[model samples]
Structure formats: structure tokens, C-alpha cells
Target chain A: MKNATITALNHAMATRQPVAFAKNLSDGTEFLLPDPHAPEALNEAGRLALAADKSTTHVLGSESWFIEARNPAPRLVLVGAVHIAQALAPLASMSGFEVILIDPRQGFGNQERFPGANLVNDWPDEALNQLKPDMRTAVVTLTHDPKLDDPALDRALHSNAFYIGALGSRKTHAARLERLSALGHQAESLQRIRGPVGLDIGSVTTPEIALSIIAEIVAVRRGGSLGLRVK
Target chain B: MIDVEDVLSIAASWHGAGEQVAIATVTETWGSSPRPAGSRMAVTTSGKMAGSVSGGCIEGAVAETAQQVMASGVPKLLSFGVTNERAWEVGLACGGKVQVFVEPLI
Candidate 1:
């Protein structure tokens, strides 16, 4: 195996992109398939490894190859440190997401409320700008205040965030969508937002609601059929 | 939080420091293996080591093999399971089978 494959693996790890490393066990030939410098068959296998987030042995004609997947960890960006955020933050963390809570309110977004969390005291827009919601990120806006949620939602829609959610009632979500539309987000793009934000698990309390949202997030992440399971 | 193991970066830095290093990964498992596939252990020829392919079952053997791989620049694939005669040597008596792939960290 060449040092180039290792270099590519470390580079992908640093840049937080998905990559697959294919090794021809027979000859010890190496390829890192972020668009491999190899045959088309290996590319197809690389794609499968990436989609499965798994590493395994595959046969290509005569040679046996091991495909190793290095996928970036999922991230959850909560735009409010409300009661639900308090519950959702830890839940998402436990479920394997780097949770970052953003709230400009010092009192609410403090370490006292979110201990051992990556808290951002900047405005939602500024926070999202620095965060750069990628394909592995899930952004959830829990603050019902239009002033806070709208900007975060706007920034999220403009990016590649896999799951975008907003906490509100059906009526509030309708109004929120209209406001986003006025900001020039097309209807097709705006449709990406899962307003009323959660699986319809009939959650009544803060923790249950947080569970519902995290469940939906996980579903989308795992490509489960229950993804975007809104009422 | 996301579970990012520090072992790979440690190995890379060790290589950067001019140490000869090798990486051992649990590439396959059968039955109830202690670690799943993709678990890794980094080994340097000077007896420096980090991470584990199998929880605690075969670090010593894997590290020894890693050192050999570094010296020869040849990758090695090893398989281990509970065998009646060798069960006392490696304590995977009741556990599952595991295949480890070891190669130099070039």
C-alpha cells in the first residue's frame, strides 16, 4: 500500500468528508476512492461501502479487496437553548452527534444550562455562517420566536444540512414558511424544512418532544422509512 | 458527542516523528467478537502502541506482528478464535473469531 492512501484518509478525516479506502489484499495495491484512480468496478464498490458506512471484503474478478469506510460523524446544531433544547442536546449527544447549541441569550445558553456542551452565544445567522451546515449536519430551531428561528432556518436552507427542523404548531409553521418565502427561498427548497418538527409520537412534555425530534433526526440519518414522519 | 478515537492521529504524528509504525485493524469477525469490524490498533517498531483491534484479547500478539510488518514492509492478515490447545495462550476461549489486517503505516 502507498502512503498516498493514508494521506487521503487523514485528509478526508480532517475535512470531514466521506471516503472509502480499497486494498487489493492479493497484491497489497491501494486506492482511495474519493473518485478512485482505478477501474469503474472499484468505484461502484466504493460507493456501496460509503452508503453502508461499513468496511468489508469484496471480490473483483479474481482479486479480493477490502473496502474501508471513513465517514464523518453526524452533527446536531440546536438554534435555541429553550427547555426542549436542554433535553434535545443531551439526547442527540448520547445518540452520537456533536451537539452545538446556539442562543444569543447568555442566561439561557450558559454552561449552567448546557454543561459540557459546545454553546454558541452568537446570533443564529452568524453561528450558522461559521458552522457551515454540511450534509452530515442536522439543524433544529427550537425557539418559536420568529426573530431567532427565521434567520437560522434561512441559513440552513441555503446549505446542505440533511435534516432541517423547526419547533412550532401547524399554524406557526405555515406563517414561518411564508416568512421564509418572503426572504426569497423557493417553495421547493422551503419544502425541505420539517416544520412542526418531529415524528407524530403524540409527545406532550419537553423530553418526549425532544425524543421525537431526535428520533426523526436519526431516522433521516439512517435513511429509515420513518424519516420526515410528520403529522 | 461523536466518538473520534485519537489512535489514528497518534499513529500519523508518530510517523511524522520518524518512527516506523504499523496499523492493525479488525477487518472481520464471526460469532460474538469482542470488537466489531473496523476497530484498529496502531503499533510502532520501538514497542510504542495505541488502540486495540480486539478489546483486550490479542494486543500483545497483534503488536508483535505489527512490528514484523513494519520491518518487512509486508501486510499480514491474522485470524484468531478459541482452539482447545491454544485457548490458554489467547483468552478468546468462549468468545468469537476475529480477522486482523496489519500493515506498515507508510
Candidate 2:
């Protein structure tokens, strides 16, 4: 029987057909395919097909695309090279995200602070024209200046960016919202903004605020609940 | 070549090599988990795995399951509840239930 099974496995490997239930050891467990006497036995294309068949499309809580959804790493565009942004760009890069830092304030957006980041010192809209935020992208405004933040927010609201945030206190956020509303942005459009961004971890320092904001963006991207951090 | 695509390519390469690999993903979270949903960790047949499922809370159990999946060829869904003692033992201190999907890569 073992010999027959082995022979069948060999035939299957050669034919690129899936080997039948040689075994179903356990649920959620990994199993090795038996080696077949074929050149392609070790590099079975059929196995990949089978694995893909078994792979499930799990939607994550993050608003951004799932890890399995795309062929490329998505971009996280930070409009403002603030102290917090200096901390954030590196963090995002290490976490497998492409980080782009934009600021019209040339001195602030220089390489000294945003090393290894795609630095754009143009105004937000003009810079964003090149960056091209997509649905798979995440956008954050750390500039805090209304002139810089507003145009970027306006364009982002119209774009496909999954996570959009603006930095400021609650009062500042309220005022920003009022301005956006006056400009004809609907309630839902304004809702997309994660203003006064980041999780409420009582972050007061640049690094701390950076952590809080990054955590919140991650949470939104993952579809995870804001939970105690928000409250 | 050492870009984000490279990381995913490495993952796909392992999957194609007939290695039993389990992708542990963070599907949802409540409080503070180090890694969130959509974060992937691939486990090799010999009991090594990549990616974080939930900080460090569920790594041990997930790793054990990953080895089994590599050996067994079955996919399983696991959930860790934050309130459970095992949660603390597993590292779900944030009181969130993280759903992990463990499947053999190939």
C-alpha cells in the first residue's frame, strides 16, 4: 500500500494534479507533502495551487488593504515634518510601510530629520500630486498649520486614502471641522478625519504622541476597535 | 531588491517550497496589541515562524499549532480572549481577542 501510494504521489507530482488526502493530521496544522521521484517534485507548482486554494481571504480591522490583498507595500504619507513626524517616518518604515514626509517648510522637511524618507518641501496639494494617495494609502497631517493642513485635508478627503488624520487639540479639531463644514464637506467626509489623532495614551512628548498616532492609524488600518485607548 | 516586495517574495518562496507554513494574522483587536490584524507571521516546518500575531501573548501556542499544521496539512482558526488567564500567560493583557488563522502555506 505504501509503495502504491508513493507511486500515485509520483504520478500526481508529474501531472501537476493535487495529491489526494494522503493525510489530514489536524486542523490548523501544517503537513509536508511526500517526496515524489520527479524533477519538479520538490518544486511542485500544484502544491502552491493547493495552498492558495486553502488560503482564506480574511478581512482585517484595518481600513487599509489586508496583507494578502496587494502585490506592493502601501504608502503612509505624512504631510508635515514635525518632531513627531521625524519619529513616525522611521517607525512606519520599520513596520513594512513606505513613508513619505511632505512639508513646504523646507528647513523642517530636510534630510536631517527625515532621513530615508521621501521628502517633499512643496505645498501639500502640489506635493501630493506626485505622491498620489490611493485607497491603500494612509495620510496624516502633522503640519498643524491651517494653511498646510487644509489643502491636504481637502485633497485627501476627495482621494482614496483609507486613514486621514490632522494633529491638534480638541478645540482646534472642532474649529477645523467647522471650517470644513462651511466649505461644504459633509458630516461623513469630516468623519474620516482622525483629528486630535492617536490613541488617548496621555501622550505629551513628541515620541509619545508619535506612538499614540501610529497606534491609532494601525488600529484603523487593521479594523481593530479603538477600545480603551480611545475612551 | 531588499524592499517590501522582497519580504512578500520570501514569504511566497517559502510557501512554494512544500514547507508547512502557517500565516498568523491579527484579524481584530480591542485594546493594545503590539501587532494588529493583517500583520502576517509565517512559520516554517521546523517550528520557526515570522510575524507577530499579538505582541508576545500567543506566540508559543501559535508556534506549536504552526508546527502541527505543517505536519498535518490542515488550517485552523484560533482565538485568544483577553480576560482569560491564558490571555495574560499568552500576552493579551490589553483584554482583546485576536483571531489567528493558521494554515499550511503549501
Quick one: best lDDT, which candidate? 1
Candidate 2: which stretches are off by over 4 Å?
A: A1-70, A227-231, B1-106
Write the residue-wise lDDT of candidate 2 on A1-231 in tens digits.
122333443455445454422122132221224336322432243254244433222222321211222224557899988888878887787665778888989889898776667888899988887777886589999877889998888888888898898999899999999988888899988988987888888998888888888788778766788722332
User: Distance (Å) between predicted and true CA of B73, model 2?
Assistant: 20
Top TM-score hit: 1
Residues A120-202 of candidate 1: C-alpha lDDT, one tens digit per residue: 99999999999999988999999999999999999999999999999999999999999999999999999899978999899
Q: Distance (Å) between predicted and true CA of A213, model 2?
A: 0.7
TM-score evaluated only on chain B, model 1: 0.85
| Segments in model 1 whose C-alpha atoms lie over 4 Å from true places | A1-4, A81-96, A106-135, A139-231, B1-4, B82-95
lDDT against the true structure, per candidate, is: 0.85, 0.65
Give candidate 1's error at residue A10 in angstroms: 2.5
lDDT of 1 by residue, B16-41 (tens): 89999898877777777777777788
- Candidate 1's error at A50, in angstroms? 0.9
**Could you give the interface RMSD of each candidate, to one decimal?**
3.8, 10.6
Residue A12's lDDT in candidate 2: 51
Scored by Cα lDDT, where does model 2 land?
Answer: 0.65
